[model samples]
Target: DSFKSAAGSQTAKVQQVVTSPDGEKRYWFKLEGGQASPGMGDSPEPVDATITQDYETAAAMSKNELSGTAAYMSGKLRVSGDLMKLMQLQGALGQMPTALKGIDVDY
Candidate 1:
């Protein structure tokens, strides 16, 4: 899958929480040994990092319209734990837009 290829040997468990008017949506992106996948709800395993942002910010990031670093610097995103690990996963994260191409998503 595109996600696996994008992961490319980088290993990390990342918890992403997106807040919206309805509520919060939680997802876990687990990357290991050149493979990666996402799961809904809380991460079963201890995560290397957690990122929380509003729905708009999350959508922007997913669409590649906003960079994580930029979001964090602008106070639109919040990150906790293992900052270096999250920083290292930027390449993998940057692949999100390409990886999700053609998927039908409302937001």
Candidate 2:
């Protein structure tokens, strides 16, 4: 994920917790020396930062319709733990559209 690219030479674990009808769901990825790897389950393997937001907010943020920084400032997004990690990802959030370009989905 671009978040990992934004991590540069740092090592960080960024987790996202989204509210689900049953309760909550979690997704996360880790970055080490600029490489990204996905993680599974509700908790991060070694959480450096966590983002607590609903699916809608996440989607909006991902699509570039909403800014993570603005969302964080407006309470639409919440972050905990090492806020610095989240800060690094802030710019990557804006690149989602660019990243989505030239994609051909067979399905």
Best by the TM-score measure: 1
Q: Write the per-residue lDDT of candidate 1 for residues 1-107, one digit (tens) a residue.
A: 66667677888999999999899999998888876677999999999999999999988888889999899999999998999998887877877777877788886
lDDT of 1: 0.87
Model 2 over residues 10-85: C-alpha lDDT tens digits?
A: 6667788877566777888765765656556754376888889977787777666888888889998888898876
- In model 1, how large is the Cα lDDT of residue 60? 89
Best by lDDT: 1
Local lDDT at 37 for model 1: 74
lDDT of model 2, residue 10 = 65
TM-score of each: 0.88, 0.73
State each model's CA lDDT, in order.
0.87, 0.70
